[model samples]
Target: MFFCLLSFYGGNGYAENDLQRDNPLEQYRQLFAEQQKEFEKQRRIIEEQGKEIEILKARINSLAAQSPSSQPPATEANNDQTVIAATSPKKKIEIPSKPVGQAPPQASEKPRPPEIPRLSETVGGVLTRKGNLVIEPALEYAYTDNNRVFLDAFTFLPAIAVGLIDLREIKRHSFIGSLAARYGITDRLEFEFRAPYVYRSDSQRSRAVSIGVGEDEIFNASGNDIGDLEFATRYQLNSGSGGWPIFVGNMVATVPTGTSPFEVDFVQSTPGAVFPTELPTGSGYFSFQPSITALYPSDPGVFFGNLSYSYNAETNENVGKVDPGDAVGLSFGMGFALNARSSFSLGYSHKHVFESEINGQTVNGSELDIGQLLIGYSFRFTPKTNINLSLGIGTTEDAQDIKLNLRLPMTFDFLSQAY
Candidate 1:
């Protein structure tokens, strides 16, 4: 039994010794061979992708060469995918065959400044373009009412009169039609001539001091004739820039061509009351006026103003030598463009007249103050024609109660082809 047991133990020890002698190098070699196979598979896949990239680059080069214009050959680095992407063709732009409301490229080389709508002839908002002519026909209507008090007896005490008192009221209506022509001598200067026809009608009411009639007496008179002619010249002083206003200088001359008030005969309608047989058509005095106008443009609006002085020449009449009063005038306004074709303006005008002289003697109560508020509107019918309407409301007793004027201006460009 002991020999059997020893043999069993010795057999087990020999098996353990054989297991310890086995080498790990053979297992490591087998694992390395499997990893090498995987490396070769990955290398083959990378080579296939490179060939595909070359094929795409060749296609891109062929397409670029087929274009209408040829470009210089790219460098080696430019053939890369990133560089090629940067050089891709841009989308073509399509232009319209006939462009609307756009000036030709050659004509737009020096673009003109924006033009503001014209308000009135006196204000001189914008000058006529060079080599152009403007013809304007205008119609105007005015109405006036006057009240007067006369004392036949001398005053005995302050605030007390011991004489017959007379009261009178007069209403008048006037109409005028005028044709004017303006020519542009240059871009900055213009000349204008105007001729007008005038018609007037008047009604008078009087209460006599000694007459027995209780109702007011009425008198009516009317006259129609050619009126004074006018000539004007305007020159621009400066170009508006750097937040500066544009200035224009103007001079106007008038010629008396109509009937004078002294030429008309007056007849006494009642005691202490007299009325003219016919009304006068004009002032019957030559006059000259020099003025300066200024305009400033802001966003969406324009401001304008003018100052003037009028000198009336003395004239000889049957009554005596008469010197009409000199007048100082001023006006200011603002205009807003409602749209591309329409605009509106609001303004105020004032004039102060000095005392008149008759035979070197100052006429009592001959000084006058005239004030009016003006509202104007303009509409453009075409590029060469427009209509302007203005209304005036009197703010002083000397001024007309209401006045309305309408004008149509048409322009002709004789030298447009030359330009």
Candidate 2:
């Protein structure tokens, strides 16, 4: 009986031991499963965070490509923080630190300089700015001396033609004072008007042969009167830079408001000797001149040129059918800016006039070629005033020997004050 009890107790002890081992094993399995679930959740969050970081990096690269130099530092930081918060839900993310001594992001490039008016502005006859007014009072003087030889007989038959030679010398002086007003209608357009008064004096000395007898005569004439009225407009076609050239188109019209030479009566002092009663102050024809001007600006200087054509309307007077010749003109020059307020220029001007028609026939000696060398100087008196002086030297016989001109230009801002 004793032996049987011992055996049963040992079996009970073995069962309790096995049950205790099973309970500990079950607890360990549950804890391991919980740990695996937590690991998986963390891995998924890390993957999402990685994907968000990649997206943020792409956006940052895109912004840098668009304007690398213009973006602010604060803007980039805010964007980075926003991405981190959306991706890292359970853990805090550390922002990357910038390198020491790193420079802040820069702004865009500097702006261009303002357009300022310079002495070269008027050298091409173009307006500088809108709402600007320029008043110019000017004076011009010219002197000319001419000699003519007249033969009464034909040149082919020298033996049949008697020695009839006449020599005439004429000296003339002219002075003009004018007031011109220019107003800018827009930045590229300008209007101009000019009125002039003229004074003239002429002296003629002639030696004539009549029937082989020579006689000398002298006459003098002087006149003072108003000259023609002129109106002009200038429009700038382009603004130039670097190697490009600025172009301007101009149209000028003249009115026959002064005394016409043809209207004056001729007094016969002696046979074959006729003198004008009064001197003429104008061409007595309505005319229009169309021109184009070009200016190319280089460093410290500018080059300019102009081409023009003038058309004069026909007129009827006491001298019968009169059609004045059309004329074409060309000028070229270079201007040097001596300083901020002064400039000098040298140029050449040429004009070719077509033959004039009288009574439907072309007149001999009516076509003229005129050329001149021009020198000009300009000085700014004040911010609103400038003085210009010019000299013209004749290069052709028909041109005046010398001419002097002075102009004073003053500016005012009428519209600005009104506004």
Candidate 3:
């Protein structure tokens, strides 16, 4: 009886061990199903978040389209998109659409150099945009004084002459008001037209050479008329990339429309003294000038230079066929941007004129040298309007003593409808 009872207990214990093993396998199957469901829920959440991101991106783009200026910079937008993507699920890297080994297209709206003050009328500070027009009204004033001594007889010693001596002093004043219009055909090419009105006055004092006169006689003359008309075209030669200088080519032409010196009447003031009854308003001949300007932008300042050549056409005058002298010019300067709306320029200008010809004969002692120091300032009053002022001081006898120029430029866009 005892042996049978022990065998029964051992069988019961083995049965309990088998049941425990089966329960564990069933539990494992249930745990696996729960884990799979959790994974599916997470995947659905990721898809929903991605769709929300797409909707947000569309809304942002719509707002940007309505107000273009309100849009952020390209770099900033790209960085924001990168941050958004990093916070989400990982994605496969995409290949670029462009072909491999090909260089990227250069950007047309690259950073441009700062604008400088205008040093010359032919060379403007900045170019007008395409399909735009700029109208500039300007005023100028100049003053000069000249003194001359004429000795009719040969000099016997260092400061002594046996013949008559004539002493004269001349003071001149000039004023000009002009209107100019500039039109941009393309981003790199422009045309300009300018018309000027001039007024002049002169005073001359002379001592009689024939008599031993201690008193000087004074003569006065004045004139006012329309001055020469001018036309100009400018073209940009380069894009100024890769640390290269910007180059511009300019062509200017002048039409003679004012009163010429030869057309003016003269009166005899005293013995061996003659003066114009009315001062001249313009040169007698037409002129054409070609010039090149170079600009290099270094930090905090800009270095600029210009070279030019002028040719005067021959004309028939009352005396003879008069040919004005040709001239060569050189100028260099540095400009600083004082602020966003203001700038300053300092420069030097020089010109050398060849001898003139009368009736196909070269006139003796007719060559001249002109030099001046220039200072310019520019201020922008609005987005489309600005004022520029410049002062010139003569450094040579042939140049004017002092010159002041003021210009106000206003711009209008003609292609805004296309946008």
Candidate 4:
């Protein structure tokens, strides 16, 4: 009876173990069904979110189309889209087709006004954009005439006085051609270099009472040489909008690379006649100029002004110790846009020079004042090319009588991808 009981108990335990093994497999199947249900729910949620995004994008595009300035012009927008499509790999969205003979969407009830093209802000003497290079070739012509009188002292008896008068006339003509290159290091900083070639002709006529001369003795001299080399830098201090004016600071240095008048040999062709072998192309000493420029924009026109001070370093040469006078300058101008491709400008400039020192002594009658009236015009040939013309008329005795200038400016870009 004990053995029969043991066998029955063992069979019952085996039956329980088999039932537990089937329950694990059934639990795995149930877990897998629950995971599939969760994944399906997430996928449906994602599809709904994608539809919402598409609807939002369509609404934003519709609103942009209604605003003239909010979106680019039709042609530009098409071109931009074409560029994006060509540069990117993206899946195209398909639209559902109507069953048969579906009607097209209705036109917008309110039509958007046509957008006017924005005017180009480029002007003469303006700084270029960052990472851009500008090359300007210019030619200038100037003419001036001066008259001088010299008095010779004579021995006087009692109250009677006798003196000799010398009258002199001098006429000068100059032509300068320059090539300037400017580069923008940043949005607010720029550097420039300029090299100029100078050609000059001088005519002098003098009459002296001591020397018997008929129709005064006339002498002519001419010289052609390179002028001073200049390096300049400019920084935009602040960019102003509305009623404020833009401010720019500038620094310029000039090297004494040209022929100096003091270095030229003096020739005496006849008695009481003295003349220089050649005309000077530049100042003999180094100079530095610092200036501040301001510009105020008012739609189709711009008003500009500049204030500057220049300092010249003294030099000791074969002639003697010489120091060129320091100068202060002021200028004000207005530029007007005539059309999309042309502009005009009118301006005035004034300069005052202090007395010069020679051999540690102040030179008498060395002070000078000069003033000029300027007019300029610019025409754009292409997006990157311009032609500028200018005229300057002297308004003071020490200034040149007239000056004419022509300039051609071209722009280029390098390493554009780095910007």
User: What is the C-alpha lDDT profile of model 4 across 249-310, one tens digit per residue?
Assistant: 88999998999878788787545457888889988899999988777777688887788899
Q: Pick the candidate with the highest lDDT.
A: 3
- Per-residue CA lDDT of model 1 for 2-104, tens digit only, reads 9999999999999876765575676678789999999999999889767765765665555444432443244432454444353343532221222324455
Clashing pairs in 2: none
Scanning candidate 3 in windows of ten residues, the lowest lDDT window is 92-101
Model 4: residues with Cα > 4 Å off, grouped in runs:
1-124, 152-164, 269-271, 415-419
lDDT tens digits, residue span 135-228, model 2: 9898999999999876665566654655456677989999999999999888778898999999999888777664443566788887788999
| lDDT of candidates 1 onward, in order | 0.81, 0.77, 0.84, 0.76
Candidate 2 Cα misplacement greater than 4 A, ranges = 1-128, 158-164, 210-215
Scanning candidate 1 in windows of ten residues, the lowest lDDT window is: 91-100
Q: Which stretches of candidate 3 lie over 4 Å from their true place?
A: 1-107, 110-114, 151-164
Candidate 1 lDDT (Cα, 0 to 1): 0.81
Count: clashes, candidate 2? 0
- Best of the two (3, 4) by lDDT: 3
Native-referenced Cα lDDT, model 2? 0.77
